[model samples]
Target: MRFLRAAAQALGGGLFLTLFVVFILQVTARFGFNKPLPWTDEAAVVLYVWVILWAAATIVPEREHVVFDLLWNMAPRRVRLGMRIVGNLVVGGLAAVAIPATWDYVHFMQRESTPVLGIPFMWVFLPFVFLMLALVARCAWAVYTALRGQGLEAELHLS
Candidate 1:
């Protein structure tokens, strides 16, 4: 589990760096050289998708995703646990639905190609599907941990 978390964080970090570099190159080429890299826009967009998705996967284990913790803290212990489980279940269901739907959309887009990148449009959408699936898995794991009486506060060192 620690290895997976480290891997996710490394992947997210690499994607973020790629995005930053691509964006900087794009800006530099367009304004400074009056010529933009043909693949820069598409590459940046794709990198952004990967970064956002992978970052979520990386952060989930760390309990960095946004939550209404104030309300959760005010609730009774049993209520809090129930709410956590229910919330995870709902998120998991949404992810399950999103994965197939997004994949279908990506499949449809596979028939088309991006202008500059010449890559299938599906390439952009596929990462989103993967991201949703990762989120689903992360949610399931969270619920499992909670049920085992291992709350995020205990597992994660927020400081």
Candidate 2:
């Protein structure tokens, strides 16, 4: 699991760095060289999608994403525990729902290719499917911790 986490972090970080470099290349080519590379924009877009999906999955286990927890923070310990479990379960259910839809959509694109790169369209959505699966696992862990009496505030580092 830790290996997977590390790989996801590296993958996301690398893609983001690639996107940044690609943007710089695009800008320099357009303004400095007066000749833009048409492929750079498409590459940046692809990198952006991969980076965001991996980042979202990485944040889920740590509960580090931006959150509105004012109400959850104010609840009693026992109530917060229940809320934590419920919240995790809800998110897990959402992930469950997303898995099949994502898979089907990806499968539906089997015959298609991306306009710019000519890569299989399904390849673009593989990261989305991976994120959804990771989220499901993270939510399950969150629910387990909550059931063991961990408060939402504490789990999310709000306490």
Candidate 3:
């Protein structure tokens, strides 16, 4: 688990670094050289998309996610348990249901390519499919942990 966490962090960090480099190149080329490279702009945008989705899918902890938990904090342990299980089931189930269509749409876009780089659209939007799968897996694990009555402590204050 530690290795997996480290790997996810590394991957996210690498993507962010790549995006930063592309942005710097874009700025430098436009202002310093007075000749903007179109590919840098597209690369930066694509990398930005990948970095954000990758972090959300693999790096962000569940506790760090935004939540409206006033009722959860006030609820009894039993109710909280029910809420956790039900909430996870609903989220995980929806993600699972959407996977087929997501895959289909992503696959369908393989015919299209980015204007500057000529990279396939499927490659660009592929992280969304990864995010969807991650959601389903993460929520399923949360549901399992909630069933075991673990990791369900109510926060005293929102972070």
Candidate 4:
């Protein structure tokens, strides 16, 4: 499980770095050389999407996602646990429903190709489906751990 978290973080970070580098190169080429790379914009956009999705998945195990916890914090531990479980179930069900709908949307877009990259647009959009699925899994795991009294400590640190 730790390995999975680390791998997700690495994947997200690496993709984000790649996107930044490509974006900088594109900007330099456009302004400095007066010639822009045709595929750079499309590629950077695709990589950015991947980075955001993977970052969400990577951070989930750390309990870094935002939650309105004022009420939960004030509730008894048992109540909090129940709230967490119910929330996770609701989110998981939503994600499960959304995945197929998103896949259908992606399939609808499959015939369209990105202008510069010439790849099917679905390839770029499909990550949302996977991201949601990952989120559902993470939430379910959190509910499980919480039920077992093994909830992860909050990792939000104030600077």
Best by lDDT: 3
Measured with C-alpha atoms, the lDDT of residue 9 in candidate 2 is 76
RMSD of each: 3.2, 2.5, 1.1, 2.5
Q: Report, for all candidates in order, the number of backbone clashes.
A: 0, 0, 0, 0
How accurate locally is residue 104 in candidate 4, as Cα lDDT from 0 to 100? 92
lDDT for model 2: 0.80
Candidate 4 regions with alpha-carbon error over 4 angstroms? 59-62, 152-159
Whole-model Cα lDDT of every candidate shown, in order: 0.77, 0.80, 0.93, 0.79
Q: What would the per-residue lDDT of candidate 3 be over residues 52-101, giving only the tens digit for each residue?
A: 88999999998888899899999989999999999999999999999999
Q: What's the candidate order when arranged by decreasing TM-score?
A: 3, 2, 4, 1
- Candidate 4 clashing pairs, residues 3+ apart or interchain: none
lDDT of 4 by residue, 26-139 (tens): 999999999999889889988988777767755554446666666766777777778778888888878887888888998888999889878888887777777877877877
Writing each residue's lDDT as its tens digit, candidate 1 over 12-108 gives: 7888898999999999999999998878988998788777766665555445655546677667777778887898899898888788777888899
Q: Give me the runs in candidate 1 sitting further than 4 Å from their true place.
A: 59-62, 152-159
Indicate the worst ten consecutive residues by lDDT in candidate 1. Answer: 150-159
- What's the lDDT for candidate 1? 0.77
Instruction: Give the distance in Å from residue 88's predicted Cα in candidate 1 to where it truly belongs.
Output: 1.1
**Distance (Å) between predicted and true CA of 156, model 3?**
3.0
Ranking by lDDT: 3, 2, 4, 1
Using Cα atoms with residue i matched to residue i, what is each candidate's TM-score against the true structure? 0.81, 0.87, 0.95, 0.84
**lDDT of each residue in 34-86, candidate 2, tens digit only:** 99998888888878887888787774446566767777767878888888788
Model 2 clash pairs are none
